[model samples]
Target: MRITRRKRLLIGLVAGFFLVFVTGLRAFDPGFVTSIRLLGFDGYQRLWPRTEADYPVRIVDIDEKSLAKFGQWPWRRDRLGELTTALAGMGAASIAYDVIFAEPDRLSPHRYLPELTREGATGTELPDALAKSLPDTDEVFARAIAGAPVVLGYAVLSGDGGSTPALKAGTAFAGSDPTDALPAFASTLTSLPVLEAAAAGNGAVSLSARDTEGIVRRVPMLFTDGTRVYPSLAMEALRVAQGASGFIVRTSDASGEIGVGPPKVTDIKVGDFPFPTTERGEFWVYFNADRADRYVSAADVLDPQKRAAIAPLIEGRIILVGTSSVGLYDIRATPLGELVPGVSIHAQALEQILSGDFLSRPDWADGAEIIATFLLGLAVIGLVLAFGAIWAAAIGGILAAILYGGAIHFFRNQGLLLDPIYPTAVNLFVVYAAATALLYFLTEREKRFVRAAFGQYLAPEMVKRLEASPDGLKLGGEMRDMTILFMDVRGFTPISEQLTPTDLVAFLNALLSPLSEEIQQREGTIDKYIGDSIMAFWNAPMDVADHARLACRTALDMVRTVDRLNEADAFRFRARGLATQTVRIGVGLNTGEACVGNMGSDRRFNYSVIGDAVNVAARIESSCKAVGADCVVSEDTARAAADFAFLEAGAIPLKGKTTPIKLFALVGDADHAATEAFKTLADAHARLVDAIDANDVARALAGLASCRALAPAALHDFYDRFAERIDAMAVAAPA
Candidate 1:
């Protein structure tokens, strides 16, 4: 649970790498990430779409029905002339052709006249008058366009070098020339000179950009061929309809950031409508599904009877002329998930401009996304480290919801396209997954260490308790009131010397195995093994309410267990014709404040206890050997284990202590403590301890002798040791 600095740095580096990868993807505008971004954009449109299409823009669709009624496409320039005349008569604002007139009409009289002249000619001078009398179909269409409010469309090619459309709108650059920044075209295919010249304005119909998936999501409002910038069909239509003489292009200023230089066309002003566009002068079209309300069949417009019924629809609207006929191959994909006539894309852009509802992903939006990615990634990592995976996942989900919901809300309510998909996917899922996985591995390793270190020393339940809360096992010390136990086999060197190394190991395992179980069963953690000695403690790495009582009870149980082991060993040794040496252990229990936790250098550490209390416990165990008792505990521990019986051992100044402290010989559990004999012995032993602490050598001797007479076999050695101490004090006294 303790995240090292190195691990944190690694986590941060991984998160940073993701941010950089996404940012680089955005900078390069790679097709895959762009595809996902566009998909998200499409999702936003679908969830809460532009439900109203109220702009005065209509598409004169040359649909399947129209093709059926009016014959196939290239419906004769004269018929197109008639259609244009009809719309002009109906008071249409502007008529823009999404169809390009790149070449002279094939059905023109010029073509037939030349063919007929050749058919009838011998050399020259054949059907000259007949050729002169035939009216040219292109002239007819050109004349009609000249007479009507029409904007001619053209296609811009990448390198197919063709004629460029004339820039009808007077363009004035507000900042540096934006031709370099605008979408570039090597050449163009415009209407025939006669037709383009006669039309009120000319604009490019070719889309400057397409999504990676080949969906047309935006149309450039302007494009540049060399140094000349030209407007799109939709922009030109709106400009001529509004009677604007020119377009005012606002480019970025040179005074901005040093490396950025001047930006591309930022806004294209046409009369009173100031349209916001991408740096490339493109507009994100908030498309509506191909709507019946926005269409008027071209055939219907050409039909005299039907023309009257549809006149209102085309009247006073900017009519875009293009085909929706599938055979014509003019249909294009849109965010609305429908294929609409390409002309409808132009119509929708013009509609959005006129309505002043735009979808914009500004230059600053990229910066915002980068920042969000970094911050959200950090938050996720922090949450996972501090609170673990479950809480981190909950918080991550909430963050993702907020981002997605906010993006949708902005797109629907404010027409601001703020991308949430990249940040949510990268930060919430990708970064979260990386950080969580790293933490999981690190924490699991820590858990394994805890289990391996404590598994053999603690009970299964205790190991589970430590595993469940490994965070408490910080690699530093904290002072806590603890009960430390130190147990050692009494006089084990002689027993070890009598046996072979294999026998010694077997003997040690047999003696330490049950002792470890006794300590672990009483909720004690074994610190380590020093030859025959096993040091343990309670109330750390986790909490135990009656730690002192548990330590005392473990000591009593250990004594009883060793007694049984000694009996078993004695019988086994006799049967094998070996020297019979009993296995006896001395246990010391001390209750006081000590520092407990992982200790040692960074490379190697041990979860153990230190300070005076721990040292005194070891000294108490050593004292047990001199007293010939199995267990000795400090007065503090004796008081803590109120349910157990303790016979007071005369005070002795512990090693490194200035004052003598009282000690107790742990006798039995609560049941034994209630016996009349234990109560009587406890009273007599307490009196003897008081006499010794007062330095009343004569009185201490008398009290010790009386206790020796009344004591059980277990306390006889305890009494005899103190009597010898009193006699020594009496001998050393000044005369």
Candidate 2:
């Protein structure tokens, strides 16, 4: 189950490919992703909105109330002239008309009298003096515009009539030419020549070209007619109010970095404020839903009595003259989903720029989103592979929450329009789901492989444990503290030689069945069997905290079970006319650092342990026959098993080893270990080993004799080995 370098590379490439795919999609910005982004923008506006209209911009709406009071649609041009003159007299900074005066007013005397003559066919032509005395309605409106701060609005049409409006603001560029980057118009719908000539400035009133979902999200600050660029209605109004001379188009090349592509217009500087825009010079309008505080009815402004009521609202404020009447067809959609007068869009843009609280999507936003998607996706992939699907999902969910929360914070506090939903969906759901599914499939495959490979050798419980955490079945060993156990029947070879092959097989199985159960019950993994002996270890495949103690306990339980089996075998052997010899087993347990994992070739391998410690456990088992003990453990095991009593056995140099390791014979569990008699026997055993090491034969014999009398029957074999050691030392000593 090891993930090779090539496999890891492939995984990274897959994730990288996903990142590249999404990033390219973002670059191209197809309709679906754009729609998602717009949804996020709408959510931000809804969650944290500017409920109050605090900017110094007012809308002179020709609303339903005004239409009711002033008759019907397209009220007399003299009345519109009177409204304009009233706003000018009230100290308004500037009055911009969102309405276009395209044709001559039919109410004017110049046109009405001619219509009267055509209908009657008997009336003589009016006198020249009388005709000259009657005032023209269009001339009255133009005179009103000439005497006040007024910016007339014109439309950029896509049809014929290619007449361009006069550009009042001087145009200049700071860097590369910005004419190519500005929004282009094929034709223009302008006011009458008298109105256009009388106005202080004229600008295009058309919305930007990129309003998705029919929402007026952006408004162009300027537009081009092939030769010259002119400001929009909102921009022209602000320029006239501040008495600014011209528009300063700041291009990307102004920053002194030679850009890869054609330079884009980054900002439009007017007066003291520089408004940030998209490459096409469009401003993102932060809208408030038809605030009542921002509106003053045109009827109220025109009436002398109500004029005083609205004079305070218009003093030194930029006023937009537009209609919200449904019949006028000037209604537009905003971020809040409210239909407001189209003039409100221009008013909001100017207000946002003047208040310095505009929403901006920086040029580097795409790169940031792409990088974030890649890193987040990679992290989720690694988590799912290293842990599991559930854990990876939990972590990914947390990150998603943080990402969205951060986006909201930036939008509310910093006025940034970052798209959090698109990036989050790509990383958390798209990439994470794919990686989790792949990991889950590979993990199940690994579990099935583990079960098939170790099913026959390991106990059922052991196989189940391996299946639960198949990541532990990887090839190559991990160095860990492990307790190794080696068990063998005492006279297995002689006993096997006496039986037929079939009988030997049956006998071995009968003996090994209970032994394997004892080992598995204590959470020991059986490595392999050598003839009648079993080699197993604890703390592999899964961690066992008290591994050394568990191995010791399993060894003792195994010895007791073998003895019971031997009693049954003795009775059967006597009836069969065979020798009445019982079976016995010796076990050796050692605890130390060892490398435990699968070992061998690529085709076949065994989950086993190897190191000097494993060899020492085998050598310990071999020495068990000389000591006449059922089980022996190294000092490492005795220290870890606090509940058991140990009789200290003398150290012996194991075969093929330079250093000798000390050994202890495990006696019983805590209850027996706490007995006064066991304590006395343990102290005596320790003294006997110390005496023998110092070559004091008299003290060694006395100590061994005392232990033999005080110890349980299990200590008899222990004392016999010490007695032989003392005798050998006495014979080898010099006089």
Candidate 3:
């Protein structure tokens, strides 16, 4: 139970070794752990989502309403041209189409009306201007696009591409080339040549994230096909709207404080606005809930009446034109748990760019979390070894709450992503493992202590008891009748702290010398000494006359011996300039059948007794501190030693037990048993227990008061604590 400095350090090192192993496993970053970290980030968004603001950004949704009014998929380029013109007329800063125009419009007059002209004899000849205008619909669309700051979107195929996207903006790197950081795509499906040439800029609409579930959490700000790097749809929109010529991509520095990392993109700037990004050149999106105010139907932009009414939402806003129709299958999931149009992702990204309020994880984030996990693990292990499992767990729970809550707060207030789940999880596992390891170590040390204490055969019977069984060298032992006694000094910690090592050793020897003499005289064998406590058993090696009675006599004598030392000032504490203090102890005795002989690890063995009865003795001794008694014995021991002066304590529940055990305090020898005062006090104690069993709080309290008055001064604290327990029960009971 007590470890020296060297042993404690060894324990810490063992736990630290375990910590390093677990941290290595985490460094592997398995999929499940990644999912857990992502899930945690998602929860933060759900709890404190971005607040909606009227930014200069909007999504021109080709929703079900628009589709119903405009017929079906792939409306003629003339209609798209008309929609483009309407947005431009409404003062849209930049209109980026999330749709594609890969082929020429089939409805152009030369392709269809030429047949009508040949077959329909009854139809009049087309007017010259109308015929010319019908054949040049693509030209009309191209002209509309050329008039506005329009950005054309293209599909980025994952496999080999037929053709790379035409670059619209020049890119310049600030440090070592970080081309690898930009997501690379195989090919692209660009707009029609004429439409693409007319647009102010062309960008890839494709978005990729850390998750495969298509949850748009982080979207790349830039992309590349082996030869050239291109801006994403959102970035292109910002550049075109701001009339910026080229972009600057900054990687980590090669000198000074920001140096020392592998070359990765640190920030990207478009015009005057710059923002941080993940090493992969991706921007983290802090999303708001689906807002009706953020979307304007394509039909509304086309409808003269609706367009007049909704012009405010379109004016001066960078609009992303994309289909929100479910049948189109362009819907994607968001961290806010909503199925949104693909264009909504771009819109939110653009919004954050404009507001300069981006969610970012620093390069040092991983290192910070690893250190945090290790430090917390160390603290938890120390607490478990020094205190106990319950106290450590309580403190761990509080620390974990603070960490998780702080993570949420930082995300909400500072747009910072800090993970708490992994560290807390690591700490939880560390605490459990440390406790189990320490328990095993304690058992092994006790075995070694037992071996050293009884290296020589103290008695011939002890040698016979240890060697008589064939399995003596083995740990499995034989059962025999025994009487177990456990004794502990109550205030040993504080008392030991006050004395020097030499003085403390001398004091302990002086205190234990007389107690050991009484036990030996009574034919009790001392099993071991754990710190200031003693464990001894009777009838283990050989049977003695009334072994239970002898054990009880030894316990009573030990109590009186401590009392004598305190009264005589035996240790001379006052001479050291310290206030006079009495040394207190608690003793427990139990008689039952227990396993006795050489038992422990096969490599090392010890002569000892272990069983439920032995465990009960230890529990009873511990409860003496709670019951305010010097010596307590179980019912079996009381029955074995019927002539001893014993007063009933109670049927109290011990740790890890289903039923309570009956216990009594051993007062004196047979002469004390014959006294009338002992009998009266015993009667009162019995009535108090009966009142308590009957659930009569008032009667129990009154009986307890009477018993306390009749009992000796030593039991007053027990009665006082007993009354408090009864009151607590009454308050907790139903009215």
lDDT of each: 0.82, 0.83, 0.81
Q: Going through the candidates in order, what is the number of backbone clashes in each?
A: 0, 0, 0
lDDT of 2 at 486: 96
lDDT of 2 at 76: 71
lDDT of 3 by residue, 1-735 (tens): 344455567667777787776677567778887777788888788888887888999898888998899899878777888999999999898999988888887777655575577687538766667666565677778999999999998888877754677789999888877777678888888888899899999988878746755678987888877667788888889899888987888888633328565678888999989988887789898898879988888988999988888888888889899988999999999988999988898999988889888889878777777777777787777776676567778888788888888888878788889889888887687645665577566646645543454434234344444333212332356787789999999888889889889988998888877887777777677887787888889875555679999999999889889889978888887556655377889999989999987767778766788999899999999989777678899999999999988877778788877998988878878888888998888788888888887878988888988987898887787777678778976997689
For model 2, give the 10-residue run with minimal summed lDDT. 1-10
As for candidate 1, its clashing pairs are none
On TM-score, the stronger of 2 and 3 is 2
Q: Candidate 2 — which pairs collide? A: none
What digit string (tens of lDDT, one per residue) describes model 2 on residues 500-598? 998888878888889999998888888998999999999887777899888988988998897787677632555576663777889999999999888
Better of 1 and 2 by TM-score: 1
Quick one: best TM-score, which candidate? 1
In model 3, the runs with Cα more than 4 Å from the true position are: 1-18, 113-133, 254-257, 430-735
Tell me the tens digit of each residue's lDDT in model 1 across 523-589: 8998999988999999987888999999998999999998887677632555566665566789998
Model 1, CA-based lDDT:
0.82
Return the TM-score for candidate 2, rounded to 2 decimals.
0.70
